[model samples]
Target: MEKDSGKHPLFFVTERLEFPPVEYTNEEGLLAVGGDLSPERLLLAYQSGIFPWFNEDSLILWWSPDPRMVLFPNKIKISKSMRKVLDSGQFRLTKNTRFDDVIDLCAQSPRKDQHGTWITQSMKKAYKRLHEIGMAKSYEVWEGSELVGGLYGIDLGHVFCGESMFSKVSNASKFAFIKLAQDLEKKNYKLIDCQVYTPHLESLGAEEMPRENFIKILNEKN
Candidate 1:
């Protein structure tokens, strides 16, 4: 990755696209921005530690920021309250079930201090396509046959790039996340690409590292 000083970033047309160096001024990681979110491009981006994150009206912005946030499957912290909730057995967890529903709920569920959502319709369509191709998966939490909480993400070789998650019932999403961590660990997955930082994720033992270090881990696993 080399710093690009050009006025506008280049657009990559091939499956394998190079990301501009993180040393550039933009913390946004605006590397080679505009491109269609074809399955090929999405797969290549994930494999190269790049991801698309932009609004509906914006161009397909690709990002590979300097400080990457990630979580190791085995390192997820289970709070005492969450453990009790899991033990209660009020909700059942299912894999690859109601993925579109999960993403929809994630987009609709309101955060405490936020309005609107980052998961636009176009993003939904792209990820749904990824799911159809088996590159993405969702975990659904069911309470007596009703979908209450769930999460979705892209699953590469040994990494799960989490997109978004939502919970209608208390601790439902957390329970699903814990199950995901356990399942991924059993399958020998190395890390979870969280994309950005949040206090909720930090409480679950996510940590931030330099982007170079994160890419090193990705390359090592590859």
Candidate 2:
């Protein structure tokens, strides 16, 4: 979606190693394009409330959407059915245990809103590197020894920026999400960064905050 910089977005060169002010983004929240996904760049992006989202066929696209969707760690809603699923002992949860598996499953999982996957090969590699460095985390839902569901994201100390999640069984992902929120609440995280909206997340108590406020809060905390 490239056009003249004045009318569209900034051209992000890898050697320059910096991003344009997110305020320069066009209406779609695309701030810049064409950067490498080195761990340094990725970490900085998350810290600045920016994230890379592009397909293999496109240049690396960066975004910082306004009215960001976030979930307070203490405000996660657990439906009665979810509670029943939890109480049933149908699954067990673990953290940072299988990030590669989780991300792979998420990439393979179909989405109703789009065709193909945004979690490209480069994205997966970058995130796995982040996981190796303790900056990325995953939550695994296990039914017996089988991994049925999970989610992965970058953890910026006080806020966890969720990337993607997938479930092999009904409510497995939801169970993992609720458990994650409960645990993070106990650990004093400010919120979970959902980035964009999804009705599924909204149903679980995620809400929108202004972009300026979201960045301010992200900066103020971690």
Candidate 3:
């Protein structure tokens, strides 16, 4: 039987675990296959510019769209207001601190005009494992003793692959992102993988690069 003919209607699993070419993904870059979110699978997926995203009860969906959105840490724009916040030093920033808490908060926090979340329970557990193994890291913004905002993602070689972020206070998420970019810059990290497009990310200096270009960069550094 043809490979596509035997695959699950909504998903597929590789017989020997190989990803389709990034270009073979649909217009949205949703390429083939569903596999467990084993650490090895997650790492391989990300390294190829694919990531798992799905709602509860659905099989894991992997994607790697064309015109990928990314941020070069040194290229992150700091607006006047954000610069003021940074200058004030009102919030304390820490790395890999309370990561599980940060992920939980992200899952619970509501997005404006959106019901539910994509950060399913299984994903949370998977990433938490990634964190424990030091492949994933969180950047948290704290107000006094409270954790107000943060983001998390895998750190593969020279890439900081952003998965999701949430803000509990105004500009909190932005601040945490700024700090992440700054720190990544210090570490000589190559890119902040935003995965998809968003006006908010554009305002912060993220731009689109073709998927092929992205994979080339990723592979070059790996």
Candidate 4:
């Protein structure tokens, strides 16, 4: 999840939809500011291993943090209990079936120690457009007919730049994630870009990778 704190200090902002090298980012990985979320810009950003993470109150903040968090698809860990959750078949998953509902639910899901969401209205529209164009994708989890949890992200073939996820019921989002990793593993994906660290993701085998290494992998995979 892109649940980042604070902002870059007085970096240059441009109305032009361009980003500098990830190496130019401040210590916090705030690259440049003030770019529109156009499809071309968004795709270029992901391809460069950068993503936007500002809220409505601030200008669009693109980030490419050092010690980036990532999950190799083959390394995803499923605890014994979670394995049972999957074995029980309590929930089902779908891909690109309910992108709109998945993103909207993720925006509404609450986070501890966080107020409001970073998934702004314009952000949603931009990503939705990407989805329409096959550059973005979503995975949905359902219990019976009710949608419970899911995630959405930019798909750059071998590298999936995960944006965010939400779970309404226990283990629902985990189900979605595990399913995604397994499916992607079968498809020969190199990694899932978790963006930053969180205990929740670490439990599922996400680890911090050097920024240069991450960018190198993106280049190699893309």
Question: Considering every candidate listed, which one attains the maximal TM-score?
Answer: 2
Off by over 4 Å in 1: 1-25
Candidate 2 C-alpha lDDT tens digits along 144-173: 999999999999999999999999989989
Ranking by TM-score: 2, 4, 3, 1
Q: What is the lDDT of every predicted structure here?
A: 0.83, 0.89, 0.86, 0.90
Winning candidate number (lDDT)? 4
Rank the models by lDDT, top first: 4, 2, 3, 1
Model 4 clash tally, residue pairs: 0
For residues 45-84, write the lDDT of model 1, one tens digit per residue. Answer: 8888888887777777787876888999999999888888
lDDT of 3 by residue, 122-155 (tens): 9999999999999999999988988889999999
The stretch of ten residues in a row with the least summed lDDT in candidate 1 is 8-17
Steric clash pairs (candidate 2)? none
Model 4, runs deviating above 4 Å: 1-17
lDDT of 1 at 208: 94
The local distance difference test score of model 3 is 0.86
Q: Write the per-residue lDDT of candidate 4 for residues 154-201, one digit (tens) a residue.
A: 999999999999999999999989999999999999999999999999
TM-score of each: 0.89, 0.95, 0.93, 0.94
State the displacement of the C-alpha of residue 87, model 1, in Å, after optimal TM-score superposition.
1.0
Instruction: Give the true-structure RMSD of model 4.
Output: 4.1
Better of 3 and 4 by lDDT: 4
Q: Output the better candidate (2/4) by lDDT.
A: 4
